[model samples]
Target: MAKKVIPLTNTQVKQAKAQDKEYILSDGDGLQLKIKTTGSKTWVFKYSKPFTKKRSNIGFGVYPEVSLAQAREKRKNARELLAQDIDPKTYKDEQQLKQQEIHSNTLQVVAENWFSIKQSSISPNYAKDIWRSMELHIFPSLGKYPVASLTAPVVIAVLKKVAKEGNLETVRRLAQRLNEVMTFAVNTGLIHANSLSGIRAAFEKPAVKHMATIKPEELPELMQTLNASNLQIVTRALIEWQLHTMTRSNESAKAEWSEIDLDKKLWIIPAERMKMKREHVIPLTKQMISILSVLSSFKRPYCPYLFPSNRDPKKHINTETVNKVLRRIGYHNRLVAHGFRALASTTLNEQEFNPDVIEAALAHVDKNTVRKAYNRAEYLKHRTELMTWWSEHIEECAKGSLSVTASVVNAKFG
Candidate 1:
């Protein structure tokens, strides 16, 4: 037969006094009040743990601090847990540990973790910009908050404020970067889902603006200005190399001699140096080879780069070197170093060259993963012919002649 329990009253609990030794007074079920010799009273709940059938006692706090009614409520809730075969003490401990984890893993902490992994796959400059954006826009406001507590509304409000300031572009980047961090959190098990995925829709998209560049017909005049300009030999060579190869500013600036294969007439940029994180092969043309030859004359013997920095022989020239040179030569706002790629793309497409080959030469990867894999080496042959034609066309544009012999083109543009 089950033993019957008589619940205690408020008056009896209030008037109860501690004896010489500690003793307990039962309320009902698993609830009891233990009064110590020091007059301290604590509410204890005794129960047989589920599965193990082992007896355990858990405290609901002290007497006046946890009033009889409050203790009774806790007892009721605990009984429900026990009825479902969940040990109340283990449940409480697990909940406490989760709360501690939430408090410890702040957004900034997790972002730092995600960035450490992300930086290896991107350029150093880009990595700096990402961290700087977070520091300026995000970390100041919400960095200290736990990632788990980062609800969509709270994050959207932050982005909306940035949007209202006419920094729509910044807001766009912030949204993208924040989404990455949140998605990283999800993947790392710090959070369950990325609730902030839709935050980008809360702001207006920035207007598309192509890089500024002169018309293809103006290449001769620009080349004339470049030739007349009193620029350093290495800087001019850097600009010409980038222009001829149709490579990005940083990619050209950071070029290493080892990446060039003179025998095969190929410059193979490793996956790490490329923007899309894929290896790019540029068919070195006659003009590109000439630029390399010019750079080779003054190249430091110990330097691995074709265009080493003037101030630091160990490092390559600044990525902005060509842009500054362009501005100095009166092409400010008229042309940028990046404008070289656009100029090349426009000229090739206009010349009726294969668009896919041109895109491949430009190092633009196909969006389709499977097709991209198949096409990586597919366009090399077509690209070789296309590069030769483009180099010849550039020679014609420079010489202002209809036909250019190999020797004459090499002598003039090379």
Candidate 2:
């Protein structure tokens, strides 16, 4: 009941031994104020709430920091709060929780906010890819760890886990990218550290395992087999399109009929879908036009897709369909769908075309300034010529000509 109020005058407080000068003040019925050696006093409320039923001591404030009159007022307030069935100790803990929440909503939270804000600026495909890597790999591991707590060892652990898989190259690349994300967070003053730079040198890298492309001479037979295979019509058309237009698999896999202008004899790959992040226009050869012509015999129009699936007929060709077919035809490990472009590049170079012209045909940037300055034609003429020769070459292999094999082309390119 705390009815006793022991107050010490300044002289008595000074006279008492340092250890003996404890002054206790009783605030009404339930609150007690205790004065310490340094002349500071605080209000303590001793009580028990529900559940555990253990006694709790809550400090209101220091003496003078909470003056006598203020202390009495607080005691009355505390008693009123207690009467209302609220535990003062629990109420104070709830307040501390709120204050902690406010501080936590700072730079680290702001970094995530910025990432979301900048997401729309990038292509949706890239955004999804990056977000996936962050969510699956980065966030699960460190999302709740404060950005300030981020360090080299922590970041290295995330990458080493990926490196343990056979994809050493991708692990290396993602490690570099993650560091960039962390550096970006730091530039915003969220992490105050660029952990990427510190850990970049520490990650052990594996030697590159280059996948060999089909020899050029060998490509003619391969192409002939692909063209004649009883594969799905969409699959056949896509293969012919790759050979004729020399476009990437993903670019052609997601091709919309609208991206192709039969009358204009062109295929315009949007910047978002292109790995180089630039609009690429491919000059369609007569062979390519024929392939598209066969594909358009389906139900979908110029709006949805040129190569919509047969089963659903509402969706574009699954990106993996080409690789799946390659495996089906026994080129699983030796030749991939992407190998078609590499084979075409080598063949085109062997056919005595200019290097820049061939690169332009592949929609690659020319390194020479002089060549690039006036090289806007994008090899439409040469690409057309190359496609005609390429199609005929594939036909020669279908006829089983001994002179045309992948081995011969391999020697030429090699």
Candidate 3:
């Protein structure tokens, strides 16, 4: 025989008072309102595990907060689970864990995790730039969303906004990073696929603008203007050294005293510093040696960098310092610091220097892996000769007497 069961009503639950001992008011089908001696009222669903027949109580919530109607609805759902042989408490726990997983696998959280794993492999400067890009573009909009919730349309909207702002290059880079983060999420099982994998073609392509450079005939005027500028002697020498060696602005700016060999007339840049991640040997010409000698005379005794910063002798000059100098000389977009490489490559090739030697001097990696491995020091002698001729040619260009007839160039280098 079973005790008579009456469904709970809001009026009865509200008027119920706690007694000396805790007691339960049953509403049938395992739903009960528990009144504690402390005057607390809670709604609980009592049930038995299907396999073991072990009794378990699952709290729906506190009464008054979870009204009679809401408590009854919760109990009905729990009964459905029990009928299917599922423990309601276990089901609740599994649901909570799923919610926790969704929160943990958010786009921003997973992107940061991926960045931590990748930062160790890249340069500190490069890593800083990568983080800056994300902070400026990606995190604010999509950070809180779970990686699985990010769709192709959602990502395209973000990138399209950046492209519309005329920062197409930033858009391109952000697209690449967004793809990388989403791909990381997929690889880590946070999502099923990378939604941004094919999103690049949807944005506008940025126009290409090559670095501005002077024509060969204009080198004399440009050199004279640089010499006559009110720039400091050290800065002037740094510019001259760059022109003579044809090194990138950062390579010239970050140069160290130890990398130079005056005796051998060489500058050996380490693998860590070289853009190609391999050591490069520059054959220093007489003019380059002269510029280095002048710089050495001004070197601070405690500074290890060849071109120490003016404000802080312990640190190298700002990587933009040389470019700023170029801009200061009224050549802002007309010529840039990196333009010297183009100037050299163009003039040297025009003078019939061997293209392979010129490319090797530029420290460009050979595309073919087998050739790259064998040709790391290829055409060393020819490059040395080319540098000497280039130095002499620069002097002639400065003197306004450089004659470049095809026959003259062919006979001289051939």
Best by TM-score: 1
lDDT of each: 0.85, 0.66, 0.81
Question: Which candidate order results from sorting by lDDT in descending order?
Answer: 1, 3, 2
The candidate 2 region of ten consecutive residues with least summed lDDT is 401-410
* Candidate order by decreasing TM-score: 1, 3, 2
Best by lDDT: 1
> 207-294 in candidate 3: lDDT tens per residue?
8889999898888887777655777666776777777788888789899999998887899998788776778888988777766766
Model 1 sits at a Cα RMSD from the real structure of 3.6
Q: Name the candidate, 1 or 3, with the larger lDDT value.
A: 1
Alpha-carbon RMSD of each model? 3.6, 11.8, 6.5
Compute the lDDT for candidate 2. 0.66
Name the lDDT value of residue 305 in candidate 2: 81
Model 1 clash number: 0
